[model samples]
Target: MINLHWIILLPIIFGTVVKLLPLKTAKKLMVLFQAVLLVLVFVIFIEVRKNGTILENIGGWPDTISITLRADLLASAMALLTCLLFLAMLTFVQNKHYADHLFFFLFLSLESLIIGIFLSNDLFNIFVLIEAATLIITILIMYKKTNLSIYDGMMYFLINVVAMSFFLMGLGMLYKKIGVLDFYALETALSQVKDPDSMILPYAFMITAVSLKAALMPLFSWLPKAHGTPSAPSEVSAILSGLYVKTGVYLFIRLQLAFSPLINTSELFMVLGFITAIVGFVLAFAQTDIKLLLAYSTVSQIGLIMVGINMGSPQAYWGGLYHIMNHAVFKSTLFLTAGMIITEYKTRNLDEIKGVFNLMPAVGMATVISILGIVGAPLFNGSISKYLISEGSSGSWIEYGLIFINLGTIIVFIKYGQLLFGESGKKETANSDILEKAVVLGLSMLCFFGGIFGSELISILFEVNFPVEILSHGVKLLLFVGSLFLGLVIYYGLFKKKNYLAVLNAIELGFNEICLSITLFFAFMVIYLKITL
Candidate 1:
């Protein structure tokens, strides 16, 4: 029923209506509503698993005229990941210093838009929801009022809105050609077209726009700046890095599914993904600020996910999706732990900070587990995803590329380990100790145990046969040893020297801007050729 759509609207509507209420009460109510929404997402996840897909058409209109909400396997997986990330964020922010009501409102609004993005079966609807998300996130970025926050927020707004414009134009062109905006309709129309190349304009445009949103390669400049700026409330950063960026990835996947025949080059995605991964880690390794390091790490992780999808094998698709979920959980945990650390120490600089583990052992343990998960240590979620991704890669070159990315991930996390557990001389207190320990313990358990059971979880969730070869014991041991060795090499060779960081930073900044411009130019050229040729 259309009422299902109302579930998303509940928090937004209530938050707006209660704007004048006491901020504390409003915040509590919003959190309560989000909990209900989380439950609803689980219900939908179960129902979709049982029924194949769930579709809701607004106002009793048929699928063609009404907006449609549908949940496929991919959508359900994303939704579940989102809910979990939201739960972590809520927990992390329970006693934080931010404006509770505004924070909750923004959080719910972002979640609603994300859910809308996943649920919508129509291209136009996806565009609208993405726009909504952009606006809400922009406000969230600007909420801090710092120079960096405002500047980065503006950059994010400008770039994404520009991309959204391209999306709208592409949708308009498709609608004009096919007289419909639904995925099925557009697919049908494109399938019947004699010149598939003609559709490249829209495809390029849409992909470019979504890539910017996803922080893939060149369009990623705004990400590190924005994400690193506001102190991002830990859990919010987790969601931003964890699930928000995946919106673009999901859109790209949906596009590929609907228009695979029209797409000529999967190599572009593969190559770009590889570049992003390498560049992201290089920059992350250079960052003195811990938040920036994690932010750049996101860029690298996303690249790995994209490369998995670009491989175009069933194994890769499953792996990509699995990685998406895995990244969300562990990444959120990492960010939350980072937040707790920063809150206690009141700094983001890694060099100045000393042995925090001494102050907060629980958080220290959690941080270690999260770093292990990110670096693909054995029996963690990262290993599962990394194995699948590597297995899905076709040529030796791509496999080697994957290996390099893995090495970079290992190296960056080694630096993270140094900062998290190294030499902070801060003293631990009785009160801060308990809270920090609790949060760390919970997240660490998830990172370590969750990885061990990830295969079983994926099998049950997707109702598909997960390949045993990819998850074999030998492969796990190899990855563990290889990654550990790589970490040690980087730690002794590069991080200890501390000379490559500046070079890596400059390269990342330059590469991101260049890629963004080139992609946008390519899209524009395609559109021009379509019009004039």
Candidate 2:
């Protein structure tokens, strides 16, 4: 008998098997396993494209009694991107083996959990996968056993545990009401109900948890500590900023659709997105460490994605979805490049590092391409997707909101771009790997060319026609250039001179404060849902 379940189970089995093998064998096995998983993604992609949505009920039982694995355009596309990304990342760490067997096991397990999330159509499975992912990430974040890493890892773990508690409570409420934990069944059950407001409590609980997972405002401190900390591996940070956070976003979209009939909180999220975007940039500007800068930048980009998807416009929604992929490539590559830079320079301080283009030509060039992509320059992926998002926001206040967010993004990136200039007379500071450099170059090339065919991509992915009209292209480019110029002026004239960055940095909140913030966010959501839904 043919098996469709292998797509979800095979990698997990491989991860479990690796734990029994020797460290060297486990590493090779993982690389091979990742290749197999990537191939499966392609196979599933073709199957999904041809058949629409593929579903598998476990144990050949009734849908209500068994777990379900699902594959659709969104799920398959993300899975494919994720597998390719992880495979490429594995190649980067081929030479530097730290923590030996444990790292590989944890990393592979995390992959399985993420893939499981993409495929599962059951609430319990999704929650379990998320909790599993969170656990694995916390361990990885503390892999080095440094004082800071331990602190950061604990912060991440404790904060997410609290969030997952909210998620579990929501699941309890859901099961109590519908008696089924499956997505389709729950949606069906919810639709048949007369009063949508009766579901508001569970909805608020779940969405709040997902919002925290996405690292929205007031609950995002755990992110920089985990992803931006000096002790986290480059691969760990890359995957977190590039892929894992997108898992939260995926749930955001998925749950939003499943519960659309009950409530529409898109406007609230749109406003929150703008706030996140602005705050993310401001925090980024305050960071002196390059890693922390990129960390906060991830938060800002997620905000932009949130705004695009919540706008209720097809072009914007697809653009946001497409951005999930684009951001993965560019941001992952940037983190990898930063790792290479930090290794070469022996420090993470931005002030001490300069003239990247001259010092490390290959890594520096890739970083340049990545900067272009992140800043939405013409002929880059970010530009096209952002264009779509902005177009969809036109004639609404959201249009202006996006513009301001873009401006803030440019200002912080302006500070980041400074690392690229100056003369090169220095020698090689750290040993380099051909495979690592090659992967960065390849991803950057994708960043560059993905934009050339951006419209075609949008059309194919969402089955919608979003042509890049010349006028729209010209206008967006002009606006981007203006933003770039203004960002430079502000960075040099006011932000740097007035010690604004100092104030933001000094206003740090502790774990207790973060917990308080999470509580406040949930309470506010509960009240808002009650009034609106």
Candidate 3:
């Protein structure tokens, strides 16, 4: 098997080399380098499949104390996802005017850091990677350098830096108490510790940081701005939504697992997740700007993914993982195509942007499919993941909560679907770059393929023999159809004429308010664990 360090280092090396080259040469080399990285990630995935889990300590150091890289099913899969999304983004942006060497350099550097986050087993290393990635993403978010962009970027930077301080403090606390930061070692150590309650503060601190990163509830005030800022390029928005935010979810899973023996906050996260989902869609439903709508939609879906993962069932956990992959594909497609549409129409308002089929057939087609996938329409990837998650929570109130979330998802997308009709009012032809069109379409097709073969893919990906009975659950089908029409009724009746919910879109948290939210969230977690534990 290939060394895990190389997978992390090769991209940085390639990016540095590309930065020193001329623009045209740099673009070509960038693609070549990302392809190489993707191949290497695939190899790591294969090796993990064959060997169960691959762990290596840097510089031949011992596992307990050394900086270690661990390749298990989830890590390898996320690494693969990082590479695929990077490669697609690279291809999608190759022909753009702003596709410069510096942009390529930052893009590749961020890719490496994200993959590093996936592979690193050392808590401090993960912290450094996240902090580094946070800086790069802030730059990318404000890459256009407008005054507003600079302000938006700074807001993102300030909030995340504050969040990471908690992470650093928690790391210090763990290292002081346990003297090790490696994931498995910490898990083992915690298992042996007599008083689990003693670790609750550290757990609360670390989880607060991750929850903010995952854009849970009150901490999500920054997500829409960071993701939907006009200064950010479409590809940057795509990466932020499609892959970067997922790092938070990934770390949330890891941190929870490491502390599982000591505490189980599954119930807390589930409630938070459901609230986040509801709030996300309610805000998304009121958006006029297409990109902001998509951004808020991401918040909603992440919450749904959290709900699935914390449903206390193996089926739901795997389904959450699958939905992660599904969201990456469709959301990337939507963001990329939304960029194209905004470019063509010279506006971001959903009401103004119409006749997409006539204006850009390929992008329109991709958008429709992606919307279907996101809405959990039957025979789409979202449906499959929702099915698994729902099946896992059968006969429970959580199952009904899942239903309500899906209904909100459908309603938001139904509002989003308005872009596909009416007139674009422009004389431009649907002559977008063939490569960009192909990338979007490819992602859209994966959404379909994922649904059709979801069962097999889930089994193979997670090494579980879970078969999904789509036809067996006739009620689910009925529920899905019912939700779609009901969503339509709700969208038209409640939202179309005079959107009372539109005021929700204007609500923004000031930096001070956001800080208070983080503190409140931490206090709540600490108190909840105190009462529950």
| Top candidate (lDDT) | 3
Question: Which residue pairs collide in model 2, if any?
Answer: none
Every model's TM-score: 0.92, 0.96, 0.98
Cα distance off (Å), candidate 1, residue 429: 3.8
lDDT measured at residue 194 in model 1 versus the true structure, 0 to 100: 83
lDDT of 3 at 339: 97
lDDT by residue (47-74, candidate 1, tens digit) is 7777787777888897778988778777
Best by TM-score: 3
lDDT (Cα, tens digit) per residue for candidate 3, span 56-87: 88988889878899999999999998999999
State each candidate's clash count: 5, 0, 0
Clashes of 2: 0
Model 1 spans with C-alpha error above 4 angstroms: 1-3, 17-21, 433-440, 467-471, 506-533
Q: What TM-score would you give candidate 2 relative to the actual structure?
A: 0.96
> What C-alpha lDDT does candidate 2 achieve relative to the native structure?
0.86
What digit string (tens of lDDT, one per residue) describes model 2 on residues 1-533? 22456766676677777889877777777788889888878887877777788888989888877988888888888888888888888778877858476677688778878888998998888999999898899999999999999988998999999998999998899889879988888778877888887788888889889998998987788888989879899999999999999999999888988887778899999889888988998899888889999999999999999999999998888888889989999999999999999988788988778888877888989999998998899999999889999999889998888888888888887888778887534865334689888989999999988799888876666667888889878989889888988988888998665546656777767888988898898899989988886
- Report, for every candidate in turn, its global Cα lDDT versus the true structure: 0.75, 0.86, 0.90
